[model samples]
Target: MEIDSYFIGQLASEEKMKEINPVLSNVKVNDSNQLQFFIEVNNGLDIPADYEKYFKNQVIRCFESNLNSSEWDDLSNKGRYFRDDQFLKFAKNKLFIFKVDVNDSLIGTRLNVTKNSLIVKEKPKNISSNNEKTLTTIPIFRDFNVNKFEKNILDSKSIGSYEYLQEIRSPYIVCGEYLYGEFKNFEKLNDGWHVEYEDQIKKIPIDFNKYKDDILITEHALYLDENFLYDTLIEQGLEKLGTIITKENKIYVKEIDNTTNDFIEEIISEHEFLSTYKSNLKAKNLVYDSKQIINFHTSIKTRKLVILSGPSGTGKTQLVFNYAESLGINNSKSQFNLIPVKPSWTEDSDLIGYLDTINNIYRPSETGLIDTLIEANNNTDNIYVICFDEMNLAKVEHYFSQFLSVLELQGNERKLSLYNKEFIGRVFNADRYPPEIPIRDNVFFVGTINQDESSNSIPDKVLDRCNLIELVTPENYIELWSKSISNSLYKNELKQENKVETVTRSMLNEWGDWHGENVLNNKEIEIIKQLSNLFNSTFTIGFRTLNHINSYLANLPKNQELDREEAFDLQIAQKITPKIRGNSEELEKVFDEENGIFKILSKYQFKISNQILRRKKKELDIYGYTY
Candidate 1:
């Protein structure tokens, strides 16, 4: 019977209940302790004449002592109510709104961002009425390379010269977060930026350092530091906030968010990699199977190294490249790198760049792999892809040995050795080229391998380290080919109406924890052990291999059209069988149709694995080999 929440509405009498359409007059806790509204409705859309007056009266009552602890929590957590904590004064006559559902329950639209900023440091109400009219706000807009704006317009010293400065009516201009400066009679103010008012401002004691770059003509830079803005919690969504933004559309970060209208990442898509794959199918005419695409994504998440191995002209390389294009990074070289691994690449130097011992300057590789990794480490929020096309052209085990070892480790422990210990202190430009680069989780490596005569065999060490997926030809290949060929890749088409969600560095880091403390369930563990024992006679399955299989299962998107048995069947074919490809003679006993892997697989009702074993046995008999 306890009422812990209130909805603004006209309190109806028992006699007048039929007149109100879904008029919620009371709230009560049901037997389950869930809040339930008591509504009285007629079959009409028409609202009563005194509805607003009654609603406003109830709102006033709710705002007073009637609001319980749960309602206050809802106000802050669910973004349902405007906060009076900061210096946000609404216009006296501005009408407050109650966004409600059909049952008249309050609907919280703004989430995680509606709260007032605690760190913005309240600006002075003392700026006077005259100055408020002449005040304006601006973001760190210099990142845009506008012609005159870059070279001359923002030149603080030459501010009085440009007619654009004269057009500015605001005397006091706010720039980046809470920092503001007076725009008095030309001559821009960079150092004298202040966080007005005493409460939040005095504690932080922030100043502007004119976030400058080499592109400007003069030594003076007219920009504010982004870090400073972030440090003040302005970068975080404290929407309806004036500290970072309240001027333009009343949101945070005017430049990036407003331009593209990119909302929260989760709002776009939960399964970003799979979502982007489907988007590329229609938008770019890609013909890779959805299951294959899903497997590829799960592989990437489970193991940072994904090897796309198959016959030539099977879109092995195209799949990797298309992923970058689908991420809206087709033109961004920093985030997308396609390195054509050469036959001559015996060592890692050709890809990671060797330290010039003579000059002490670290010369990074031209392939952009090292640079992309470095950028990934710095910008952990972004996702970086490095595709080694025809990776098996050279011996993969030799060139990729460093990454193979490093990928086994996690977080900061995964550093790639670049220089000798003696030269570490002496290495010049160490800032740009550290002694060893941290192979962060943000960068995922994909290698395309064609199992042709020209390519060398991928060793057990390499196989154990990566998720090896052989590309399967699409069932409707001819139809998909015709569709793709007819659709021009270059010509303009309708822009993607839906904002495609991109998988980021944070998502990559979070994959390990997606499952419980133990990645594999007891049943899964027992089956993998049985399978490993079956293959133990030939080649021992290491923890790394077991971990890969378990991770793939753990990271697979829910409702993925794959049952555990079906997926495990694929994993065995992918993770286990590929290791002993050419050496079918060694595994001849275990590969028996009636009594070996098939018997164990059939016992578990893994029909797919049983079928695949039959196919592999056929391949062994006819082609004298299997992978």
Candidate 2:
């Protein structure tokens, strides 16, 4: 066998190896050309006192010049040395292997060697220097083309080596399969990388020189950095961001992953009819205080429902229309929608909206009033109103409960349940659902009520929600009737001939003067007493009827205006006295002869008992003793 290296200890003698050798004496090379051998360094002897020193001093040697290629291979085989490529790669420049005792525990005492077995020593530390020093170094990489794998690794922005990753509880270096970093600032951060989609991670440095914008910030507005390591990133970005937020606690962000488009048109249609209103006539001079004007404004501003309850021919509907028209004049921006409420409207949707039978579309009728108001106010800031003519003929609570609740709902928009299948029979169908109506601040509601046997009684809740205004018919109905007839081009088309002859304008005005001048200011009781006593012999008046008459008379024209003057004579008036009744013999004699008008005038006129009674009798007989 060829010996290619020198040994520190002399080979054990043949006599010594015969007793302590632990392996077979004959050995051969394997396919890798490596040999196995054993020898007795000590023959039944205790370890040497300098055994540790001897082990440290041990070395292997090679004689390259003395051997041919085959001879060298043979020597390598005899030495049992194997070429390890992986070990060579790891030990390429800075790493080396030095044979040391496997049990050695000292760290820096370890030695290093090269392929040629050359030993190198570390420099000694100087003891005299006392300078304070800090050594900071970042790992540097030689130029290496980044492959797809490496690109992905960096994109992940991981924080440790591959081997170091397994030992760590979380493999941060390969976090989402990216290389790791411990960058102190954004400039040191990895760039020149692309992601599959968009990358949300952003970096902002904290140094003052790089910060161009405002750098002092609060903790509330911004948060998070590329790696989500600390809150410093949030503080820094917020410093640079410029925005004014007046309301406190108003800034935030959220990840909305699953967004969808829902119903949209119904929402738009529900808020289309917003409006504002004002009175046709304001009494600025009628009252000294602003309370009346305040009341007027408040009446228009806060109106939800109004009920004008009065007798027929009091111009109730006309007044409501006038109010609505007045609002049109003031609010020229848009016209208020006017809807006439019929007595037959019983269901809620009848006034709101319903699916049209002919066209299969949602149509708004009377209930359309509310829908129109909601639509007018849709998604905007404006005012609106809905006037209901003859609102109380139908049950107010039955039709208006939903409307009242909708009015009270606080949101700018009110979502109506139009398509709920459960509300099938009660209202509209599933085909048409009214979208939420953006609530407008200025939607006024007005209603008119005629107090008649055909009209329904108004509920107290409805009354509480309304401003009640009373109106009465004019006392001179004949004048109004005659004027209406005179203006009519259809006078010959009258269905009733007797309707023309029932009351004449001249007769009514002449009869109206009989009530005395300034009848409007007279007390109701005084008018009733005088009217009943004066007409006791002919027509009589009741308390309730007198009240009605007084209300009518109050609005009558006090001073008459005529285009032409008519002929008239001195008025002869009659009044009954108790003396006329007590003098029965005189009464009989007055009745026996053909009593002239002066005789009747004396019998009835009490202030002048001797006045001509026969003339009064004829006058009374012709006029039928009118009160």
Candidate 3:
């Protein structure tokens, strides 16, 4: 996952290919000025005899082919992210691999060999000045590997806020889009200029361990699971196949390193967590489907805060309490703290605490929520689940404002300010309760809101930060209850296999490029865009919701119990559909069968969300407002 896994190259026409390097005269181009991976042809023997099967995703992009005298141009835009003189001297080959950014329309990461990727090969020439001018044949097929090259490949400092880009670039990988200064780091190191960010994003935390020898626990560290690098080397006939993954896999961010997140993902995804959680729920006489458990887990990972809404007695609160227990977090005072929100609460002090300045003491809420946050900071390695029962009893925006603002800050910066910094020494338990309690990454905040007249409505800001899931009441409640009772006949009968274990903070952070191809492919992204447009007019939300949906999709179990499409269908239901609210008269056109909500629901194969909406439309008709 180094940044140099990609190279910035231009898509050439057949004629353009002939003009730059006539040795590839027989090569054909797919389309003009398109970006892709490619291969070269020389003497009708660029590839192995049976190359088609392996090289289907690659096209041919020589220096030039169809260029007229007036159309003279460089086949690759190598000047974009690098200094021409510096890059030319150190670059081993034109084919070097690089990493892809989350928001990259420009840079591509090394992954699958799907449709067409640009395969690049240089027509080899020996040093002619006082040296032999040996003609080197081209590689018919080549793959990519980030570990093929060493770090500080450019041997320079980063030019801007995307400073980490300088460290991950390597000389011997085929990083395709990197020539674009992003693909390339376009700013010259010596020039000392910085690129402006398109969005007003706060500068990302520096990857402090970029050069460290140790594989420290950090989100900035990249891991690539694809074998593109090995395949590329074989295609070029550069390496004998490796029978077993040895030091190579460990040194690179390849799979064998067995990252903590990878281990957690494998464990949960392989039915260890799923089966245990489902069993625990049933054993507790709770009736819920696998989809609900999956959605709940995905929501917890998508954002630390999860809002559960339903009519009374739908098991919203029980799910949170039971799921934590399945993970063996039975300690109510520490890792599991349930603070029942009082209905009359109206301010931040009601939830977090108060200054009590007259006595120069911080009186934390009796609920002990602050104590859990303090505990979270001390035990950063373990998870802390804090649930606000009846969270909607009071307006969430009032009591939870501090958390709403601070959770937006990432890593160690997320802190809840209790009082003035000067009061730390004056507070009763300065050592035990620091003035500012850091909301460590391991802390999970769950809220249960019973959707009755007693509860308050959640504002868009709260909805923006949290994934609000409205629990679907089972159609046949009596039957479900009977089944659950039968299933729980013996409390000790449930098998102890696949017992839930403590999940770490790393599992939450390393969900992997929500915006990139690794998580959701081009087809899925297209579907999201279509849905986004439809929701724009009626169900307005910001970029956070989109990203949460992607993360949720990325974290779905790899087991056949749930597919990506089905998980995404639930996400549209859980994340977007819950926000729909208005008078039935006003929303009638928006949910009309021909177009709008119903049309969008049917357009994509969102069967589950659509089913939920069917009841929603009916409820809106009878009750006038449905959420």
Q: Among these predicted structures, which one has the highest TM-score?
A: 1
Q: Candidate 3, which segments miss by more than 4 Å at Cα?
A: 1-270, 422-425, 494-518, 535-539, 584-589, 619-627
Worst 10 residues of 1 by lDDT: 111-120
Q: Count the backbone clashes (under 3 Å) in each candidate.
A: 1, 40, 57
2 or 3: which has the higher lDDT?
3
Q: Model 1 over residues 159-271: C-alpha lDDT tens digits?
A: 11111121232223322223232234323222112122212211111234333221111111121222333434243322223332111222234456556665555422334
Candidate 2 displacement at residue 179 in angstroms: 87
Assess candidate 2 and give its lDDT: 0.33
Task: Give the TM-score comparing model 3 with the true structure, all chains together.
Answer: 0.54
Task: Give the Å error, residue 269, model 2.
Answer: 32
**For residues 1-627, what per-residue lDDT tens digits would candidate 2 score against the true structure?**
111111111122234334433342312234554332221111111122233343332222212221112222333445334432321221222111112222235552321111222111111122111111111111211112223224433455422111100011111111221222322222111221122222222222234323212221111011111222223333334224312222132335565445564422211100010101111221111111112222222234332344555687655555544344433322322335566677777777767765554553456654456455555555243345566777777887887766656654445544443334444444443333443334454565667777778878666445434445444443444554454356442342222222212111222223223332333333334433553554454334443233323323332322111000000000111112211221323343333345322323222122122232443344445653311
Question: For every model shown, what is its TM-score relative to the native structure?
Answer: 0.55, 0.27, 0.54
Regions of model 2 farther than 4 Å from truth:
1-297, 329-334, 355-361, 379-382, 411-417, 421-433, 472-627
Model 3: per-residue Cα lDDT over 1-627, one tens digit each = 112122222222345445544664322233563223333221121122333233233333222321211111222333333222332332233322122222213453223221112222231232111111121221110111122211222233322212223332321222221211112323423212223222111111123234122111111122121132224323322333212322233343455555645543432322334455676776666777666787788778655579898899889888998778766675447899988999888898998888877886778889888888887788886778998999989999998888898977777788888878977667776777677888876888899998789989898778878877878755555676686576453354344424556545654444333533346677667756766666565666566777777677766654323556567777777777777777876677667777666655542356667777887888887898876
